[model samples]
Target: MNVLLVGCGRMGGAMARGWNGAHRVLVFDPMAAELPDGAERVDSLDAVEVEGELAVVLAVKPQVFPSIGETLRPLAAQGALFVSIMAGITLTGLGDALGSGRVVRTMPNTPAAIGQGITAAVAGRDVRMGDLATVNGLLEPTGQVVWIDDEAQIDAVTAVSGSGPAYFFRFTEALAKAGAQAGLPPALSMQLARATFTGAAALAGADPAELAELRRQVTSPGGTTAAGIAEMDLNHAIDVIVQAVVDAAAARSRELAG
Candidate 1:
């Protein structure tokens, strides 16, 4: 498939890298460098020359879209399948800019740079099954692709998985800090925190059991894990905090999308 990738920053770069040898990928970005072979790069959108239908991946920063939205209308009208990985840009908004409802809005997190990210997508009502399949194929290389039935769910998806990575990183950092405060070497504390997070995530992915069940297995009755859980769950503080964070993020997403 031929794809026009706008903005080759981290996520765009990862997508382009995944599609480099397999397809014809054209990238438009001034800051991108060292793209793989078989991929073409241009500094400006006006320089794009590919005609006919194409799979266009919109990865430009949200701040940059308003200034450049007009430049893409022509391509969108060319019947290009627009797959957007930009956050806060709603399907209806993209369809308005593109003059085509064949748009797929996706939320891919930081881990996509390493091909482990989970990307969620929602298509406009006009999007057909083939368009969805193509978009799925295009996004699958970066990580897992989950299709949302309702566009309303994208905001929650954004809050949960989109911003979820940073949350995990912050928790890991806190764990490291607490370990160091308990007298472990700083480096050792960091290593332990990092490894524990990675291992737990791997198990979470591999195991079909509920995450709470897994936690229960590690948390013996009145053991160290139980004690830590008790402190974290005091008055359900952690749950409240998590809900607040997600709610805030989703609210912001709705605001920005409008």
Candidate 2:
């Protein structure tokens, strides 16, 4: 696979590094930042003299799509499989802008930098199964990928997994603060909070049901864990927190779409 990445910002750079070995990757970013070793770096699309069987990954911002669309319309028309990671950019929008039938719009979070991200993709009307397979293969290096039949679900996916990491980090910080309030040393509180979440996440991944059961088991008769659970359950805190995060993220995603 010959891959061309259109932007080299954080997400783009992460995907470039993750997908480098899977194909011959070329990067085009105007700023000329240092690229990962072994990837070809070009200053502009004019420098790209090759064509055919190329996978074009659009990592550029949504605002730059107009210029990029004009520049790549020819290649896109020639059947390059277009994969876009720009947030809130719909497949229909990308297809209209790029004049391409084979397009996949994806939302990938920062964890992709370390190959642990979860990405959701929606195929355009003209996307074929083969195109999807190729996109999946290319994205496999970065993390897990899921396909959605309804494009509308992408917004929910964005709210959940896309912005989910920052929420976890915030909770971790709060946990650390609470620990400090309980008189633990600052460093120890931070370490405990971080490690607790890490282990819990790992366990949840292994057996989510079992982890829930473990939580129940740990809550003995009128114990501290039970007390905390009671408070958390009193005002439907968990539901409120979950809904608030999802709503805020979805709203932001919609705003970005405009």
Candidate 3:
């Protein structure tokens, strides 16, 4: 497969790393410090020369995309499929700028740099089903891939998955702080928090049962874990807090899209 990678930054770099040796990549980024595997690096879009149809990946920050589109239009006009990993840039906006409706808009988190991220994607109305396979293949290197039919759902996905990592990090930090306040040494508290978080996540990944059921299994009826759960769920506080967080993030995403 041939890929025209436009911007080899963290996410782009990760995608390139995933495609290494498996695909021939034509990259354009004046500021790239290093080129990825099997890449024919170019300083400008004009320098790009390839024979077959290519997948032009828009991996640059959304803010820079306005000007970038002027240079990138030719690629779209050249009959390439557009797969964008930039956030807050809607499929309508990309299609309008590129003068092509065959676009795939995706929101991928920072974890993608390590191939552990999950991406939520939606294709433009003009996109064909076959085109999705190309998009999935391109993103498979980063991690898991999920599709949505309603583009609007992408905003919710952005709120949950796109910005989810930071929420987990903050919770882990607070948990460690709470342990230290409960009389444990600071170093020991942090170590315990990190280990517990990591182990719990690994277990959740391995378990096939529903998350709520898993929680019930770990929590004995009259144990300390039940006490902790009671505190966390008092007045449905945990659910309310999570919903609030997602709402705030989704609202911000909508604002940025405009």
Instruction: Give the Cα lDDT of each candidate.
Output: 0.86, 0.85, 0.89
lDDT of 1 by residue, 100-135 (tens): 898889988889888999999888867878898888
**Could you give candidate 3's per-residue lDDT for residues 18-42 as a string of tens digits?**
8988788888888997887678887
Among these predictions, the greatest lDDT belongs to 3
Clashes in model 2: which pairs? none
Q: How many backbone clashes does candidate 1 have?
A: 0
Q: The CA-based lDDT of model 3 is what?
A: 0.89
Residue 209, model 2: lDDT of: 82
Arrange candidates by TM-score, highest first: which order?
Answer: 3, 1, 2
What are the RMSD figures for all models against the true structure?
1.7, 1.9, 1.2
lDDT of 2 by residue, 174-244 (tens): 99999999999989999999999999888777775876697897799799999988988888998898899
Model 1's TM-score against the true structure = 0.93
Order of the predicted models by lDDT, top scorer first: 3, 1, 2
Using all chains and alpha carbons, the TM-scores for the candidates as numbered come to: 0.93, 0.92, 0.96
Q: Which should have the higher lDDT, number 2 or number 3?
A: 3
As a TM-score, model 3 comes out at 0.96
- What is the lDDT, from 0 to 100, of the residue 117 in candidate 2? 87
